[model samples]
Target: MICVDASGVRLAQPDKVLFDGLDVTISRGDRVAVVGVNGSGKTTLLRILTGALRPDSGEVRFGRGVRIAMLEQDPLLPPGTVADYLGDGWEVAAVATSLGVLPLFDRPTDQLSGGQAKRVALAKMLAENGVGAAAEHDMIVLDEPTNHLDLEAIEWLEARLVSMSAALVLVTHDRHALDRLTTQVGPSKVVELDAGRAFVHQAAKGSSAYATYLDARAERVDREAKEESTRKILARKELAWLRRGAPARSTKPKARLRSANEIVSGGPRDLGVRGNDLELGAGSTRLGNQVVELVGVGQRFAVDGSDAVTVFRDVDLVIEPGARLAVVGPNGSGKTTLLDIIAGRRAPALGQMKVGSTVVVGYADQHAASLDPDITVRQMVAGPLREPDHEDKALLERFWFDSTAQYAPTRMLSGGEKRRLQLVMVLARKPNLLILDEPTNDLDLDTLRSLEEFLDDWPGAVVLASHDRAFLDRVADHVLAIEPGGTMRRVPGGVTGWLEERSTRRSASPVRTTKVADAATSSSAGAGASGGGVAAGSRGKQKQASSGPSPSTIGRRLRETEQAMVKAQKRVDDLHAELASTADHVVLAQRGEALAVAQGELDELEARWLELAELQDG
Candidate 1:
């Protein structure tokens, strides 16, 4: 059954067309992911689909008795407490609890943080789908649903969405969620928008459709370039012939002359600058042996102006030169606080923190709060240098800030453009110690990829706290996991290890298994894993799971651990051979790193096997 059908949709802005002749039919169980560059009309399309905005020339029809709900990028709420805003329902309570917004139930909605508000909005939508009711939303539309969510929350949402019966349509920059939610088979479709044109691609549920689209798009661009080059050559020849200015040419047919003129006047094309051109050049200064050192660092805050709540404690770590540390934990696990301590923005209540004198910290928070809206782009970049020059203009151009944009007030820039400007400003300082807290928040995928490439070879220490799994996988070589009870543990496989541990925990629980299928397979893998402490009733069961393994479980785990160790060792061996054979320095470095990671995984597996073996022997 068709839930919603949009026919001959056409919309335009004063400056340019957003989309033309767009036809989309959303049927029962259809999962569509709308993707494009930041301003390529993703949000606009969502608004149209949800009926918030009507296309200039299109008919939108909804199936009878088919309810729909939308989670806007930034939703507005009436004056009330968080709980009041959500209303009374078990599903609402469950979703709030899962998203770690239950604690904010009594908190006024107006006072909620951006992340808190987003979570509340998401929970409200999820609740409306009706947890176990006979009737649920037939179609659900979400725009950037994962924007402010942490990895755990994202995984949970993925799980819930997988278990949901409603058809899903979403627009997001989160590649992981996109891959999980949509598929080539069935009714899943990847609708890509480019330059006012829409291209639909069919890809499998777990496939990297976005990546595939990028490759296909690049090939198409190359082909067009080659065709254009041929035309340019003919145009040049025609101009050269016309320049002869012979009397015979004047006598030639007017039509021939007109064709000649058209060819000659084609002119040189614009370079078509892109986000990839943005150069986040490494800092001029080199980092010292010690960038930051923390000993027994702990942070606690008073909750609702009452009893002190421990966020994290007894943390010891060192940030050395060229170190890349990825922080992972549930929301409210103090990841941001950890970065704050390292950046020296906030003093830890019960720990000693030291920063080297030469280590200049460049901190980019979620919101580009350091930027002044009144200033122009050129002014912001040049303000720190205290002068504007040809060099500054050149730098701005590299970051895609044209002369017009450079002169425009910062407020006139889009969210992505503003974020890029903030990035340009931060890197201008040439800080040796770079700390990013949710740096991907407002960034386009192009800029995000460029930044990742920049950091790969950057000669400085990096501390990144982000929920972007792809970013973490590309940037981080090690992981600092803030576990429950304020204890920090280093995961051997970086993001891979953190995910593995979470996977194990989820697989072990029968309740979780029913709620969240494996993240690798399901559209949603997180429905119940909340960063908020477990409910009072579940604490005992959680404690039991945390305790030492039982006899039968130990034997089973021992066998699995042994098998994993063998596989890991084999992987390490393969990487070593590849590293030895590789001639390119870049390839060699990558293989070497892979070997090290494989060896670390092997070691961890061996250790786990030993522990299980000992328990089984007893």
Candidate 2:
């Protein structure tokens, strides 16, 4: 059955059109993935199809009584409780529980973090088991749904998508998910958009759609080269005639001289796309006997108001100067916490954790929150270095940050750009030991591949926590598994062995009651009181108390927030700004909307914070 049909759709801005005369049709059981750069109108097209946005001109018609569901990049949910959102049905309850969202039933929607909200949204989407099959609206669209998810959540989503009978259209950057889920769904079509033009190709795992695109790009380059040669020849002929004492019969060529001049003077260049090349220095740092050693390291905390509950215990691990260790476990298994303890970002609850005398450690946190938001690309790169004018610019350029981006703030950067920046920052320290928690998250396939190559060549020790099977296989030589009972074991093959062990353990262990705890109390309570619940009156009182603080303090906080937003914006803006300033002006002009959106979000956040402060005072 036909699921979606959009005809002659047009999306435009004041200066240029994003998509015009675009047409697409999705049928039942179709697994389509929309491929494009950060702002090639991929999400816009999804929104248009989901009826959240109207096209300037065109018709979008769904099959009769289609019960379509959409998981947006950032979904705006209602303010009520999670149960209200999921309804009071048994199937809904089962799905929510299985997805670990049922414990959030009593929690307010506003308190949910990005990852938590994503899980809630996924639970809501999958609540009606077989709804796609039963209701005859076997169609679902997901936009960047994997963002902020951990490894376990990603695996769960992949399984859910594979089992669905619906036609799934997804826009994602996760290659593993795409490879597994899309393969299970069979050969689906791929729609690639470039410069408001759609290129459709049959999707295959390794050598299908991407190969076709490469061929097309090669052909375009050759054609453009020939055109350029012809234009040069014609220009020489015109110049020669003008220079000589010319006859009246040679007044003008067949084609209009002005038009030919336009073509010759302004034509697209033979631009070749180069992938990421992250080369780490091979000079090893001298180690003082031991790099990192953990003896009888254990972590325990109170669970549901009970006595200290053990998450992991009796874990003894050691890393020399050049050891590469991969930590693997299920969601909420404390892999990240253990890394944080070893990196000195967090203190261990018990036992001893130590770094060698000569070791300097660099840590890339699970969420990449170490970045300072108020700084420019150049400032971030040249931290602690003075007069970084030429040196900083060159370094940034090496990481694909150009002139415009070097000056732009970091707050506006995309996920991939921020990640690249983080990698550069971590490498700048030249530490002997590197601790990476899910380092491949939010990175593109090409970048991930480049990182794998870099890790393989680097001489320093690495402790990596990741769920990316392919990445672990490439970079990790030793595997450490955090078993369900909080014991750490050295496994055989890095990721494969870990997976096999997990499967065996799951099959052998008796099923326990899985409950989704409140999000605020789950992993965030010890860090801050932000997620904790307070009575409405008490909350108001606290707000009033904070508002009464000195003007200078309020100003300082506001300034900090502004700076943070600026830093984030700068990173995002630098990537595109650098690309635009260096690339063809026409392409720069074409990508204006995306840059504007990034800037607008930063502005909006600043404005919202200011508004909140004012409300608090009033």
Candidate 3:
């Protein structure tokens, strides 16, 4: 079923049409993810799709009885209880409980933080879908869904997406979400809108649609290479003729004489622009008895009726020397709360927390707000170094901060540049412990990758919270999964394993078989293997299969199917638990129906998998 078919969509910008004569079709069961850099009209396209704004000359047709739900970048909730906004329905109550928003049901929405508000908005949206009973809506759209969410909320949201039956259209920066959810669904098709025309391309798996731009870039490089080669050959021939006295028999070989003069006058000169060679010296600092320790730590913000709304409770954690730990959870699941406690920014409500005596903590918040907008990059770096006249100029240049940019105020720098500056300033102090929150946000992919490379070599211990799965996989050595109810669990294999486990849960297949196939396909075909007969191919296949069936392989596949079923069960359990724990009448009633559906899915998947396993065993 087509949810929306938009054609001739146009936007006014850059004194040109953004996407005039454009056409797009969103259908049921489609998980379409839109990706582009900032200012690339992603949000504008979303607005057009949702019918919030009209196209300049086109029509947007919605399927019959399609109930579209959209989560905006900044979702607004009314200043009433969550239950009140959600109509006190049993379905609403059930979604709220499972999403860990049950505690906020009776509390005023105005008291909720940005993260909490987003969670509430998501719950409300899901509740409107009849608490995942059936796809009443043809489609649901989410923009930047993971923004402002804690690690736990993000995980819950990811789980919710996996269990959702309706078609989803999402625009997000969360790489893990894109990789996992998109894997469960399929590759995102691109509807490239350029110069009043739209071109649709079927993106390949594991490759972004934006790669078309790279293809264009490669063509440009090829053209430049041909031009350079022709110029060099012509110059060489001309020089050879000129050296032979311009062909004594011919009248002064005009072309050869002209070419020689031109070469002499316009010879290439070294511009003295050195390539990027950033050298961060490896240094170590002694970590005292305890780098950081949190025992029964809890935090709550004061609100009416509730003494304090607990973000986390009874959490115990420790960061020893050289520990590269990662904290993950959903939007409001207390990853930030734990980070704040570690950074000495927030005191734990009910437990003891300590930092080592000699520890110097360098904290980088998501917004890079620690920077002084008024100061120049040189001044910022030199401020702490206390050596303005020293090698600070060279250091700034090495980080790609040009001379002019180095003198410009921090406010004038781009987001990536600012992040680089932040790194330069923080590393100048060479703190033994680094606390980074959402460090990959707003950073370009190159810078994100570079930072990961830098962190790998850095000797300092790191405690980071990031939604960038690739970055986390590269940097984090240990993973902490924070769930609702303030429970923190140490997950094995860091971010890669956590994501693999999550993907396994959603895919209903063994992760190992898929990975093995992928690995085999990616291996290079040797000269002999490339054109060899069927015998060579059979041998290759045998070799590939022989490399198989480790315990992790089976576990991953089982875990994926198991995780989906388990997640459904957990949602149902959360509803029951909420009903028993809270006196909120509306919430208790609302959860009853949602619990039934979740229990149904759990029962079905469980039985199906068990039967399959038993048949194999038999």
Model 1 residue 77 lDDT? Answer: 75
TM-scores of the models, in the order given? 0.76, 0.68, 0.56
Give the CA lDDT, 0 to 100, for residue 278 in model 1. Answer: 48
C-alpha lDDT of residue 538 in model 1: 19
The global Cα lDDT (0 to 1) of model 2 is: 0.66
Please give the lDDT score at residue 350 for candidate 3.
Answer: 76
Off by over 4 Å in 1: 57-66, 131-135, 204-212, 242-276, 369-371, 384-387, 506-618
* Superior candidate under lDDT, 2 versus 3: 2
Relative to the true structure, candidate 3 reaches a TM of: 0.56
lDDT of 3 by residue, 584-616 (tens): 778767777777877888888898678644432
Whole-model Cα lDDT of every candidate shown, in order: 0.72, 0.66, 0.64
Best-to-worst ranking by lDDT:
1, 2, 3
Q: Write the number of the candidate with greater lDDT, choosing between 1 and 2.
A: 1
